[model samples]
Target: MTDAAAGARTTAPILLGVVPFGLVAGVTAVEAGMSPVQAVAMSVVVFAGASQLAAIELVGDTAPVAVIVATALVINLRFVMYSASIAPYLRRLGAPARWVSAYVLTDQAYAVSLAEFRETAPGERSRLWYYLGSALSLWVTWQVATAVGAVAGAAVPAGLSLEFAVPLTFLALLVPAVEDRHTAAVAAVSGVVGVGAAVLPFDLGIVTAGAVGVAVGVALDLRTGAFPVTGDGEPMGDGGRERETDDAAGERGGERR
Candidate 1:
């Protein structure tokens, strides 16, 4: 397929995924004590998902504004790695272009764009379009969802458990991304830390758990030479093969993706 066509096709799933995520963010922001206007403004101005959610969660807890901002920064710091990952592609795109691209760099857009960029031949390349399309879809969906969720958050029963939807979304995203022993080890470590830290007050456990997870993942990657290994240190496996297998199993087992 031509790069243009491939980029467009690969971006469709992101549109679908963003609809629910955006709405969830909106609703949660309202629940976090923002007015509808403020909640919607957040979706428009700061489109990063985890950071926005972290901010809302902090506000809900009545935490200091500095702590809330700090948590948002921690959650969003991953984007620095993402920007570096895609820097080679964006370097020649000019400063304003690069900044715009960076602004729209959500996880869903990054995932789909990187996959398309790798697949497309240079002569047919269109990474920018793929990223833009996916990001636009997500941005629009999030705004609409937030509006809906603001209304629905009031009517939805606490017992029906809509709160799980956001984390469940992350789990779906994360499970697919964990295709190696190194990542699996990190996830295990994070889970252990989170469980152990559950007694901590005011959701600090989440921050600790995320730090432990990242530290474990980084340590495992260094130990295994997964991040910078030259040829043939270990057998080459599909980076996403484990994710595919688990998703297949989930389908068969009637498990949620």
Candidate 2:
């Protein structure tokens, strides 16, 4: 399958997990007194469900605009770590493509794409296409689901417990993504720190937990050489092989001939 096609296929199953979350976000926005247009616009523009939900809850409580913005930004801080982790693979893309990729980056996209990128032989991977395919699928699904929720606001029953789907989605991705002891430690530390810090003001706990988790993970990786480096200073894949370039493959073929 083409890279994009593969990404879409890989992403399809996860999309089901996000549907209820998207609906909750949309329904919550409307319940917070936002008009349907405003609710759907937030889905289209902000596109981060967790932050959107936080913002909507704050709005419902009549929080100040500055507080809402700050809270949303703080809650979304994990994107920084996600960006740093994926930068190595996407650095070769042009500026426009990179910008689009950055905009579409999400937990699902990052989890799926990073897993695929780490497993595939580098020479055979099309990182951008895979990323775009996964992200765009999410974008479209979120928009549609949010729109449905907005229109069906208050009509959908409250006992559905749709909000639970959000965490479940992350849990589904988290299991397979934690490939080694270092990552498992990172997850454990982050979850513990996040819970302990949950009482912090302005939802800063999430940010604190993410930063600590990343730091712990990186320190362990460096100490253990979990991330092997190629001779050219590029990081090797999980298999300890440097990604082969097309030219390098051609050279090997010629040599064999």
Q: What are the lDDT figures for the candidates, one per model?
A: 0.66, 0.86
RMSD of each: 11.4, 2.9
Give TM-scores for every candidate, taking all chains together and pairing residue i with residue i: 0.67, 0.90
Report the CA-based lDDT of candidate 2 relative to the real structure.
0.86
C-alpha lDDT of residue 114 in model 1: 63
Q: Which residues of candidate 2, in runs, are more than 4 Å off?
A: 123-125, 228-233, 238-240, 243-257
Q: Provide the lDDT at 47 for model 1.
A: 77
lDDT of 2 by residue, 1-257 (tens): 37788888999999998899999998999999999999998888899988999999999999999999999998898999899888877766788898999899999999999898778755324778888889999999999999999999999999999989988998999998887787899999999999999999878998999899888987997898877445654547854363446558889999999
Q: Residue 159 lDDT in model 1?
A: 64
Off by over 4 Å in 1: 1-8, 14-17, 123-125, 151-153, 178-257
Per-residue C-alpha lDDT of model 1 across residues 130-212, encoded as one tens digit per residue: 56666666666677877777767666555655555566655655676666787688778888888899788545676688777
Q: Per model, state how many residue pairs clash.
A: 4, 0
* Ten-residue region with minimum lDDT total, candidate 1: 228-237
Model 1, backbone clash pairs (residues 3+ apart or across chains), number: 4
